[model samples]
Target: MKKRDILFFSAAFVLALLFGCGNGSSQHSFALGDSTFMLDNKPYQIISGEIHYPRVPREAWRARMKMAKAMGLNTIGTYVFWNLHEPEKGKFDFSGNNDIAAFVKIAKEEGLWVILRPSPYVCAEWEFGGYPYWLQNEKGLEVRSREEKYLSEYKKYINEVGKQLAPLQVNHGGNIIMVQVENEYGSYGADKVYLEMNRKMFVDAGFDGLLYTCDPEKDIVKGHLAGLMPAINGQDNPAKVKQAVRNLNEGKGPFFIAEWYPAWFDWWGTPHHKVPASQYTGKLDTVLQAGISINMYMFHGGSTRGFMNGANFRDTIPFEPQISSYDYDAPLDEAGNATDKFMKFRAVIARHLPKGEKLPDVPAAKPSMALNAITFDKEIGIFDYVGPGKVNENPLTFEDMNQAYGYMIYQTKVTGGAKTELKINGLRDYGIVFIDGVRKGILDRRLGQESMMLKVPAGTHSLEIFVENMGRINFGPNLLKNKKGIVGEVTFGGKVLKSWTMFSLPFDKVETSKIKETKSAKQTPVLKLASFEVAKPLDTYLDFRKWGKGVVWVNGHNLGKYWSIGPQQTVYLPAEWLKKGKNEIVILELNKPEINQLSSLEQPILDQMSDNK
Candidate 1:
């Protein structure tokens, strides 16, 4: 056996001595003490790395965990996105990539402990901040608050996730060591009662292990529960962060950094976020020397596939959707390969390991291939693939239409009022305005424009507005009111427009074969299809470098979107999603069919910031 294996077993043997082995008893517990967290009645410091399961392919979970372990991290931290598990109300899915229990089991098999932050309201740049869109449909339901309606639903989700994870706690002979309650609540609101309620709900649902609260340093005290262990996030000043945690923990000695950001996240049309290893290593070293535990926010950030990506906006910044890549400039790149940052971090971790201990070997890089351009042989117009929709008196929100994600079209007629200015109230993101089936103006929320002046001719004319969800706010005070599509009213020259025909284009799934074929040289949105053969399957990126703004699909799976004005020009196509012999691709070109062919690139172009950036 390896020396490291021997050392690990020795520690386990000691734990077994203190607490009985095999289906451990209550005595074999992980508890929170004033000064330290006790495991098997001994102080233990958790060294963890965060990785979201849905963002990663199920086949790669073990490999990623192995990478985390190889980096000397003893624990794995992850948030359970509620929207993914329970896409609709009372409908829960825990199979495949949504399998929380299986993920925890894999972590245990890898000899790593787990820290579950099943926030349910996890603001991880995920659509709707992990809240189900159905929640918005609840007549008076206020999320992240003391609202009974919201709490009841929150309870159901918490119970479901808990049932899958609680039995796997270390006390029950499993690896889960900690459970965080209501992530960064204080940053959104200061509700002590709400935080306590979340804690109670977690306990009622069966999570009896080390329960805690994690928030930024500014919101730590406000979000913290009186008896719960309070952890700080994001701050780099070790002394100040330690002091803050100590103060919150009642002069405690054990300090924890719940989220140590090695790098920041990127928004669409913005430059990729990066930080030199030198920027964080010195601070990391200081924390380790001080004996403080930490969980690297994203040891590896994978792709935010499909429509799961989120958006963000502040006073200065407008509504900006995050690119599909959740790379975060992490030590491990989006494809799960190590970068220079990885080597630098590994060296730092090795130097900090307990005396005579060693980290496992880093895994090898995954294979990638570059193929020649894929010429689309078949094409169809957007109208050829229109699904069934409803007609409302006025334009309704996506949630109002029972739609979760994707685009929606609102068409109305301009009759009496020859309005100069047209306004769409509560326009979530981007909208393309047209009159008489001709494109006139584009109202992009990112540019802080929601209204446009229409040069309408006399008599009744067709008024069409095609709006993209862009993405719902995944963080901040907007989390509660994040209803996509036009929320309230549509006005023309201060006149409330009535009687509308709306179409739901909630591209949940597209059937390429079912779509009718049509060819037209006229400028309009088109769907293009192509096929290619590969002898062996290897990971490759679908190059949309030549294509305009639109979504891509491979073998009936949505690969997410790409835009001409982009920092992301390619969509990652995992080998698991590829076929051994023949592979197929379908692109739903949104604006213009500039090209009839698409190419595959050996690498991704995720840092080419757009013009408006």
Candidate 2:
């Protein structure tokens, strides 16, 4: 049971009053107690749902928060993805969808308390676990540890996050009540000293109010800190979840479930994961009946747009990359619409609301459009526009060459006219083989296939392999070194292949204005494009089941990658990025251009599994 009491940190409360008075906004006090959480000397129950700012568009932030409240959420949980905020080494991006402060502010506007999980490393199945790709290039840097170089880089970014969000804390006249320490660290390692150091970093960055660490049931003991509150994640047993945290929290009573999953995420080559609401609403009821403070892992799981989705790989499991749609099948769909789960969860929550308080009306469904097939006729030869290549005696990994996402073209001269067994020692993810602009075979790291036999015309022929970085490993021990492209040597006829010209084509921005019309590209890679007009823009799904493997862009905004593989056959195109006039769509097709036409659907085709294997 929760107990409403006086302030736990008197000094911080007084400071909050001062700050709040300065801003002319009514201030609120939130404190952690031995048995209950106190909000203004009264017990406060936090019913939160995790939502990422980067996943949802900037224009739809308020609408999403409204949806959360309508579903009976009192607070919102969010992870500030470091990679999305700071893509480069020294440069930082907090504008547009990366504007986390804006997201939090909107949450407050919608009457929701904020739980800021500003992660130096957040394993939300995000690329590199939300660690910036540039971190891989740092010399002698070890992640999620107390390594000097690693901590030093982290301090800068954490301070920047503090500068943006700390003042908006609940104590300081804003709705931010709790801030989490290094996300789910015990799932990876047990280093109390390292975690303590991380906690201190948060304090120095001005997150001195209500700090906590959350981990799985088995890991709570290992990741627990004696000084801060310990929260459990992934535990469904209400009584067990309460007891586990109570025993470890020095006899505290207010239990918090950090990540309660209603459903799971899907990867390529798997069926879409859907959890029936009836299966989990009873558990939600049990948690509320026990007075446990809980947060849904994803009240809404939006799209993992562009190359931001993550992958899973370890000794136990094979290389499995996450699909483009992050739509975790939560109460809110990927496009931010209510589902059957939403109605059921809302009913369960409505029964537990305080007297005289009722859940708001669910928002109207956002509009969606279905249009005719948008044919892509114009083609651009990718090889001709590959600009230049860096010469190297050996193959350069994606990180070594200072590249992150997209394809890396490795070109070299090879003896032809004879059947030679070609082998690549370290193909990171997936690649398309070509000899003098003609398709030969494919090498996929997921399938563990490295060697393929090829025979080209006589004389020296250009050997080219287009390697696509599916996504970096987001969990487990393998994530420390998720370098894309070729990590080892390429050999033919059992002889080491050398003298490479590496082309780093991340395609951060696709420039297709200078395209030349081609008759056809049945055997090589090509840039596919199409243009369409809309009097009024609305949300639509770019149905890509007919398309082969490639990355997509609409009006220069990256929509992310697509494959012939299962689970994800369409990319979510938001109306926010659309316009009232003409819009252009671009695709970088790596394989055969079999896509003569593809339609924009009114609804997503997420469960359309293919037997492409």
Candidate 3:
């Protein structure tokens, strides 16, 4: 049903050959035909699973690849997070966990091909859709646009990524068979010119392998270019998926599902989403029977560590920040253990592997440890750890101060109106208003409340607003405008507030030695210190069910945030970070520190997704 006629840019291919661009020590060739792709001119089917290199630790990359191979997968797909690769403009770090080339090379060693989705803009519920925080300050630089300012920066980043990956392409005698162009662009806009530019950029950067555009079935036509191959996403209906792909590619036979959602991601205050196996099983079978290629969106979703989690703002939802755990309820759990779904999926995948090629043996489970309740006796006042702040005439946004993540404090003097109407125009997220170090009121964006009537205690009262960078918006129309902290002017009683001393507490400078011991905190947001001893280092989840909302640090490494209002009661702590005998834990409790005991659980309480909504 599919045409085998080769369709390619002859000039580019010839140039690639002449320049020895496609030449490599390992000999292999990959090219796109009408219906299906070809390996050495033979029809090939890509049975792949998506996994992020940065999400999983560098030590775990090989094991994860083996897990995928054992599940009867021939290919492993990954997105090259632009922000992770290049946190700042012109500053690139490919070492440690950011070593994508190493990840790919490991996949090759595990006998698996790779699909590189290097989107300068990756909307994987990542901070600012993977755009660097510095981009916000660039005037007139609209992100995800074809505008010069944005594109110029993007070109440099993509070129850098290419430098790391182009030579590893399948045509270059490497395992990287295909490289995606501008991830799911059609879902965002109907700009053909933009898609075209992205395709050209890939070719220019030395990716001579198959280049394709993946879009939602509905938007495939809008997102696709004339020459590039089109793939559908989030569509389980085999008939519809095939129809969509064929319609776009003039009756092309072999269909590919770019992102097959096994389960969905979770937000802070909402129930975790799950797709029952029964619901997706039949569709998966139908597609496999029809000979369609699919890449499970997330085969294994590791933690969204640090402040990289993104938020979701829908029609009714205000702004829901994603929880640290990216555990998408996939075949592999957050801890990389195989779920029941994994076994079942393996059974299904086994039915369609190439002749005589068998799946590898599943790896043994990693041991987890349970520890006794450790008490936190020492206490530190949060106010004592304040960094040297700068004085400004007006409060600056987090981007203005070049502070990317964590919290910021805006302190100034307020007077005049007795019941002053305090308004924080464009408040980024949760902000607690304090008058002269006393808690006055709370201004939260979730409740859709911004302006609060403040009772200005006579004369000049010290006004302090502590704002936390909850998370940046990851997808949709509001993506380009996701700047943390306050964006616009703060007005009180029709008068613009000025002459403010702001603290840029990015928390990157958080050190245990720097904090002073205190007897007690008068109010909420107090820092507590505790130490626990482990027989030996083993993987454990730090349970914070007793504590209120805030963050936890284990041996100076942030375990991420936890709240009483949780589907997530504990943060995952890798064994590598835990020392043998004594381990120190620090918690910055935002609300009441009701419990002082800290314990580690062998199992994680991730799916409590009740009506915390």
Comparing 1 and 2 on TM-score, the stronger one: 2
lDDT of 1 at 23: 25
| Candidate order by decreasing TM-score | 2, 1, 3
Report how far residue 257 has shifted in candidate 2, in Å. 0.3
- Which digits, one per residue and each the tens of the lDDT, describe model 2 over residues 1-613? 2233345466668865544342235567888766668888898778899998888889999999999999999888999988887888889889988988888887776778889898678889899999988888988899999899999999999999999999888877777899999988888889999998999999899887888899999988888777888999999797788789888877676789989999999988878999799999999999888788888999998988889989998675568899888899999999999999999999999999999998889999999998667888787777876887899999999898888788889999898778999999888899889998888899888788889999877889999998889999999888777888999989988889889999988889877875657546556677877888888989999887777788889988888778878788889999999988888988887765655677878998888787663
**Most lDDT-accurate candidate:** 2
The segments of candidate 3 whose C-alpha lies over 4 angstroms from its true place after superposition are: 1-25, 416-419, 593-595, 609-613
Question: TM-scores of the models, in the given order?
Answer: 0.93, 0.95, 0.92
TM-score: model 3 vs. ground truth: 0.92
lDDT for 234 in candidate 1 is 88
The residue pairs found clashing in candidate 2 are none
- Deviation from native of the Cα of residue 314 in model 3, angstroms: 2.3
The candidate with the higher TM-score, 2 or 3, is 2
Report the CA-based lDDT of candidate 2 relative to the real structure. 0.86
Order of all candidates by lDDT, from best down to worst?
Answer: 2, 1, 3
User: Can you write out model 1's per-residue Cα lDDT over 1-613, one digit (the tens) per residue?
Assistant: 9999999999988876544422244245777655667778787777888999998888889888888888888898999999999999999999988998989888876778889999878889889889888998899899899999999999999999988998987767777888999999889888898988999999999998778899998888888998888899987676887799888776885688999999988877767788999888888888777777899989989988889989887878867788888888898888888878888888888898877998888889889998767877778766556676678897888888899998888888886345488988888778878776677867878888889888888888888888888888988877776888888799988889988888888878776775445454635567788889888888899877666688888887777878867788778988878888888888878776658777788788887755421
